[model samples]
Target: MEEMPLKTAEELEAECLRLLHANMTTREIQRVGIVRTHADGSGPNWTYNQLYPEPTPIGKHDAHGIIASVAGKWALVA
Candidate 1:
C-alpha cells in the first residue's frame, strides 16, 4: 500500500471541525457534568446534569481555537 499525502494544516482543521460537529449533532457522545453521590446509595455517584451547548469548563470552544490556530486565522475564532 502506498502512503497517503500529508494533509495541509487547513485541510486538517476543516476535517477536525467537521468531525466534531457531526459527532455532537448526532449525539454519538453525550456531554456530562459529573456529581459525586454519597455512600448511602444516593449521595456518592456520578450524574449527568449538564447537557449539550452548556458552558463546560473544557468545552468545544477550545477546539475551535485550536482549529483557528491551525488555519492561521485565530482572530476569527476569538
Candidate 2:
C-alpha cells in the first residue's frame, strides 16, 4: 500500500480550528483542551490553553480520531 502524506502544521491547525468552530459553542471553545501521550508512548506530555469562547472537553476517542485524521494516518487504522 502507498503511504499517506502528512499534513503540514498550518493545515493541521486550520483543520482543528474548523472542527472547533463547527462542533463547539463559543463557551466551549474557550474551555477547550487537548491532551495526548508523548511520542515515546509514555504518559501525558503537555497541555495547552488559549483564550477563545467554549466550555466542553473533547472526548478521548474523538481526540484520537482527530489527531489521526489531521496527521494523515487514519487509513492505517482498521
Candidate 3:
C-alpha cells in the first residue's frame, strides 16, 4: 500500500476547527477536548473528544499545536 501524505500544520488546524464546528452544531455537543495518543507507533497523535453530553471520538490529528489552537479558540467562545 502507498503511504498517505502527511498534512501540514495549517491543514490539521483547519480540519480540527471544521470538525469541532460540525460536531458542536449538528450533535449539540456542549464541550470538547483533545487527547494525545500513540496508537500508530508514531511520535505523537491527537484525537478530538466530545466531553459533554457524551464522551465520543470525533477525529484525529497529527500536530499538537493545531489541536492547541483549536482548544484556545474554543476557550474564547466557551
Candidate 4:
C-alpha cells in the first residue's frame, strides 16, 4: 500500500518512532515514503535524526533524520 499522508508533526514523530524501533528492517524506499508522507510532499530540508541513531550514509539524512527534522520541529510532546 502507498504511504499515508501525515498532517500534524506529532503524528509524524509517532510513526518515525515506530520505524526507528524497526531500524534493523528499515530501507531507503521506505524512508523516503515516510518522509514524504510526513511532510505531505513539501520536501522540507528538516530531518528525523532521533529515530535512526546509526543510519548508513545516504544523502542529507537517514530515515530517523528525515522524520525528526520535520516532526521534531512541531511534534507535540507528552
Identify the candidate with maximal lDDT: 4
Q: Least accurate stretch of 10 residues (summed lDDT) in model 4? A: 28-37
lDDT tens readout by residue for model 4, 1-78: 343333544565556656554555444333333323233443332344333334455522455454555454442322
Provide the lDDT at 69 for model 3. Answer: 55
After superposing candidate 2, which stretches have Cα over 4 Å from the reference?
A: 25-55, 58-65, 72-78
1 or 4: which has the higher lDDT?
Answer: 4
Report the C-alpha lDDT of model 2 over 5-61, residue by residue, as the tens digit: 433334445555566555434213423343333342222232333424424355433
After superposing candidate 1 on the true structure, give the runs of residues whose Cα lies further than 4 Å from its correct spot. 25-78
* TM-score to true structure, per model: 0.29, 0.38, 0.32, 0.32
Residue lDDT tens for model 3, 1-78: 332334434454455656555643324334445454434422335555433445334422322334565443322210
TM-score of 2: 0.38
Candidate 2: lDDT over CA atoms?
0.39
> Which candidate has the top score in TM-score?
2
lDDT of each: 0.36, 0.39, 0.42, 0.43
Model 1 per-residue lDDT tens digits across residues 1-78: 332233433444344455445544322323333232322221112222333454344554554443334333211110
Q: What CA root-mean-square deviation does each model show from the true structure?
A: 17.1, 7.7, 10.8, 9.4
